[model samples]
Target: MHIFVKGAAIAFFSLAITACSSNPDDGFTGKESADVLYSDARTAMETGNFAKAARTLEQLDSRFPFGAYKDQVQLDLIYAYYKQDSTADALANIDKFLKLNPTHPDIDYVIYMRGLVNMQADSYFLHDLLNIDRTDRDPQNAQEAFKDFNRLLKSYPNSKYAPDAQKRMQFLKDRLASYSVKVAEYYIKIDAWSAAAVRGQTIVETFSDTPYVERALEIMVQAYGELGQNTLKQHALEVMKTNFPNNALVSQR
Candidate 1:
């Protein structure tokens, strides 16, 4: 009876130790279990099991909070969250990485990723600040995405990523120009001629390189005419003609 009790006690202790070393993967549990779990997570990610990969990475982070692979684990967790379409989690983890490693050589990569995450988060299906249905509209993600790309464009203009950033900026500019047009048209419908004029002129001045400027000038001409300001109207018309000689508005004149 004494030998049997000792054996039972030893078995209980072994099981307890194993439970404390819970495997993030399958049955492999120990300090070495971390390696196995990470390997499995990498395999999961490669197989496009992004959600499972994220969970595994989370487990690694929780289990080995101070391992040599902790930083890599954190990075993988961020990517896994991003791949799994968890924008909030991805952005939060990216922010945590930036705060903790501000001077890391890969800081720029993190900022670039932040921009990408925000771009994804600015979803058409997401609730807006105004509590209105935004399902039909493009999210403001493009604006934030531009800001992030511009950080790399401006601060590291000579960076290898600069050219791609410039292309992205142009895409952002087009969307922003479209947004201004929508706002200006809204003002026009409300008989807010002054506001429309301001918005139109801003597009003309700020986004002169875009085709939207042509449309903006047309709106400006209409706003001035509606307000019964012939001089301003004539000036706008002339400017439109001067800038865009073949402007359709000029042909109508």
Candidate 2:
């Protein structure tokens, strides 16, 4: 009886170890071939179950790193991450795809995806939904997104995504230009005339195409006047007149 009990205990321990050593694909809950896993992941993604898709794709990648569909799986993972609003994951996968398949036929789409992921990191939802200004918010992510879009356009000018990327880039420029104007206004409020003038000058020189250029000129005029620089103030006023002749401020000049 004692010998039988000991043997039973040994067998139970061995089974537990085997289970532990098995592929722990959490979503799958059982070991499955890469093709089956990939098919499951594709179905989940098509149905908009991005969270499930991400989990299954991760399992497929782990179980079969050298699978026939490895490259395509990684690309699909990027899309899944984006749909899940997992921007960090999406960007990481995009980097991997770029490095591994620099000349992939769908490289333009990958570049477009990178821009979309970064764009979501700093969306204009608040401004669009609530009419709230985002001028005081950090524009770092916006700048990153702009660079991403610019890279796509520079590399694939005729890409189907180029038109939308261009529009997004212009929107980012406007947002950044407005942010600069807001900073200059803040400086003006604090009586930091030189700093205010510098901020205003940045907008005028760097983002001349944005609508905030008019407001930037006003900031420059005010800052120069506060700093007792009459010549600079006159120069700003002349610029306003040249660009916005009908503006009341220009009329006053």
Q: For this target, which candidate reaches the highest TM-score against the unseen true structure? A: 2
Per-residue lDDT for 146-247 in model 1, tens only?
888988777777766678778867876776787889889989999999999999999988888777988998999999999998898898899988989998
lDDT of each: 0.79, 0.86
For candidate 2, list the clashing residue pairs, or say none.
Answer: none
Task: Give the CA lDDT, 0 to 100, for residue 75 in model 1.
Answer: 80
lDDT of 2 by residue, 1-253 (tens): 7567666766766875675355544556567888789889999888987777888988888888898988888999999988766888899999989998999999999989988898887875435444556768898888888998999999999999999999999998998998888888889888899999999999999999999999998899888988899999999999999998987777775
Structure candidate 1, residue pairs in collision: none
- The top-ranked prediction according to lDDT is 2
What's model 1's lDDT at 239? Answer: 90
TM-score of each: 0.77, 0.84
